[model samples]
Target chain A: MSESEYAIEVENLNIYYGNNHVIKSINLKIPQKTVFAIMGPSGCGKSTMLRSFNRLLDLNKNVRVNGSVHLFGRDIYTGDMDSVEVRREVGMVFQYPNPFPHLSIYNNIALGLKMNKLVKSDKELDERIEWALKKAGLWEEVKHRLNDYPSGLSGGQRQRLVIARVIAMKPKVIMMDEPTANIDPVGSKKIEDLIFELKKDYTIVLVTHNPAQAARVSDYVAFIYLGELVEAGETGKIFTAPESKLTEKYLTGKLV
Target chain B: MYQFDMRRIKEYSFLGVISLLSFFMIFPLFHIIFTVFVDGIGTLVSTGPVFITGTLDDGGIGPAILGTLILSFFASLIGIPIAFAVGVYAYEYPYSVIGKATTALLEITQEFPTILVGLFVTQILVLPMGTYSAIAGAFALAIILMPYVAVYTKEAMSQIPFSFREAAFSLGVTKVKTVFLIIAPIAKRGILTGLLISVAKVAGETAPLLFTAGGLYQTYPDSLTQPVGAIPLLIYTLVQSPSPADHAMAWGASLVLLLIFLAAFIPLRLSIKEVRM
Candidate 1:
């Protein structure tokens, strides 16, 4: 893809929790409408950088940022920028299936749309809810009991509903933070398939501790270690012929 | 076989000890409620005024009951939001120094005596107003209950897996919206149970009200500034009075208090029930 196709541009991005600098200076460009994966060892800054894209780290009051993260070239961390808008444009899913317990699956999906005022009428809202649920591959399972609480669903179903909630927002970018880490192998494969299907329109940034998952779904791969970016290239090139020893070590399971 | 017989005796003795301990723990509670019901049921049914009229004594408890309810309602109304806000701040914004300090203070508040809470409110609120009243009592009770609400709300909010917050945040929901719309709803039952427990705590309190609420039986107070009566105070006075009718009234009030406690406890218990489905 050309430079014009880039959906996110990072320039000298650095993150800190308290006085300790976590994510070292980093720069990268994520192509539009493709799956980009961030892989790193535990406690590495891979998750931190992913969080910075949408400012999830800001939830921790002690966290401080020292670099620029531009969502489609607009500075995401600027005072004039709305964090909510940044999040809506760049949605997120976590490792665990965390469907809102009090909300029904239908309401869970509808909530995002309602909060953003995306749909005006009840019929339109219902349609949007169904559309999102279908996109997440959860419509059939939850259709009969749209009013049932999300707690009634199985773990995989709950995770899908969470995804549906994100999809309902119609974001430009969907960031999945270890989306399959908490599920069984079968459930993880289902999520992998969903991610492949979702990348047609939305730019996806997936963070995974699992290198295999990154190889499976991502078009481009970025490897991070000890709060520093080790390599960024085409996924095939990064996995099979990594120029960086760190990246090679990671792919081979020699380094955690 | 002889050695095994000795071990069996030890095991039986241990079992006996546990059973006796459980009875020791339960006996007083069972005695208190049973005695109240058996002794007070007769007086409760006989006194037309006890059931129909508000008060049981010369002052009557009607105004006191109303005062207690009104005061408690206001206290809960005021404390619930404040405690909830504090809870959210403490757990949700875990990294903030202010949030940390507030949480620590709330933790300390949990150990504070109700009397001290009353004294503090009296110094700050009741004394400034120049008279004891229901509002003062409510303020005291609210202070007493704020820690409970905060502690439970913090626990409830904290119990939510980090994944939930991450998911909501990634979806572009504002922190405030995420909490109110997502976290608060999920933690509703736990929060409800906590608030109910706080209500039970405030309902049973006598020391705080003794000074702030003035322990007066107002036939009817026009406003919160007027003195009010509560079940605890009625029980206190009834227990102390030489008259048998007064003693009977106290037992009836105790039974009523027990019923209210059970009223709140039953739903709490059901919420915890293992649904077969």
Candidate 2:
């Protein structure tokens, strides 16, 4: 594969929170326009590693990063490159559905666009918001109530709204950290289908604790435990054959 | 059976002592409000509207009311911006050395005696200008007002969960934009409550105005540099006079001051009870 085929190239990545070594040395090559899954048990440093992709880990005072994460061949954590600019290119959806509650639905979608000057005029902004919402499978449900707050929406709808917020930026890579963990079963199913639809246009890096969900959605899978990658390969190959005892144990529900 | 009965007796005694102490604590406030209304209402009725509109000769407190308003407004204008900036900085970088020092200084200043502030302003402003002025009084009040607004702002921002901060930053917004536009707006109700409560506090202050405000009740404040009389300062001066009429005037002024305080405080108190100290 060509070097340009990778959406994100994390090299010798290590993260620390004060005295604790959270993410030990690791390297990952996530392909463009595919659903790449990182699965681990809870508190296994999976979430901490995802945050470093967009420099969100920089918000924590105790965290220290010691490697480079390249986005489309541009090293994001190095000199002359801006983290704000990096965030615009890499959008993330958290475990919880967090839309800006104080803003109206219309404004929630428009905030990043307006703040970053992504769109030109009022008409352009409205068009982009409508487009993003439609892409996220939320436009029909919320079209009539665009001026309302997100507090009135259901958990699944709010999560889709968050997805719309990220999509409005037209980012190259989208990171989802257990996006459906808090939603109802029906809501989770809808998001799973939406994720399948989204992978055609954007690279989706999903973090999940459930192996079955990873098998159902992701094209490639990596199992991490105790801050180390135990195994990584195509989703089909990893599920069928055993590469490492740790990977087999984790898949069999014996490693957690 | 005996243990249950003993527990019931202990509970009743705790309730009884708590209610008794609470009533004792609130008794003085009620007694003071009752006395002020009884003595002050007559002065207000007999004097009519002039009681609020006229000068000392006309037996009105218009100048003092105007003075108090000017002082509070300007003090807020001077203090709120500085205090708000300090508070947000303290909230944003709380673990840093400067941030910790700022929080400690704010707490210390809150407990510092108000009289010393008055004396400091008197030396720096009044003595240099060669007269007691409203500006000097407002400056002193602004110093006292800073700690209240800054501490409240810090508390309000800290009350927000860390998740919101992450959500805002993840949107690619700069830290400045995230702090001022996003985070601050979410904390607006608490910040506004702080502004109103501090204004109410400074409006009722008398000791800070002793040497700063020269006590002018004869006329309305024509300029910021001129001497002025506040309702609290007027009451303080009237109570010391040997005249019976002055004592009546003091009671009426006290009533006016109390009303001002309630007008600002009650609605805010109703809207946000948790802002209470």
Candidates' chain A TM-scores: 0.96, 0.98
Model 2 chain A poorest 10 in a row by lDDT: A1-10
lDDT of each: 0.82, 0.90
Predicted candidate 1 versus true structure: per-residue lDDT over A1-256, tens digit per residue = 2234578999999888989999999999999999999999999988778889888887777789887887776888887468888888888887777777667767778877887788999999998889999999999888899999876877777778888888888989998888888888888888899999999979999999999999999999999899998999999999889998878888899995
Write one digit per residue (lDDT tens) for candidate 2, span A1-256.
2347799988989999998998988899999999999999999899999999999998989999998898888888987358899899899998988887778899988989988999999999999999999999999999999999888899999999999999999999999999999999999999999999999999999999999999999999888888888788899999999699888888999986
**Candidate 1 backbone collisions, by pair:** A92-B170, B54-B61, B54-B62, B55-B60, B55-B61, B55-B62, B56-B61, B64-B229
Top DockQ model: 1
Error of 1 at B84 (Å): 3.8
- Which candidate has the highest lDDT of all? 2
Instruction: For each candidate, give its TM-score against the true structure.
Output: 0.87, 0.95
Q: Over the stretch B1-277, how does candidate 1's per-residue lDDT look in tens digits?
A: 4456888899999999999999999999899888988986776677656453554444245666677688889889888899878887887766578978888899899888888878887888778889888888898898888999988888877876776677777766677898888787777777777788887888889888878887666366677787777778768877898988778777777776777678777878577532111
lDDT for residue B162 in candidate 2, whole number 0-100: 74
**How many clashing residue pairs are found in candidate 1?**
8
At residue A185, give the lDDT of candidate 1.
Answer: 84
C-alpha lDDT of residue B212 in model 2: 93
Candidate whose TM-score is highest: 2
Model 1 alpha-carbon miss at residue A94, Å: 1.2
The per-model DockQ list reads: 0.47, 0.46
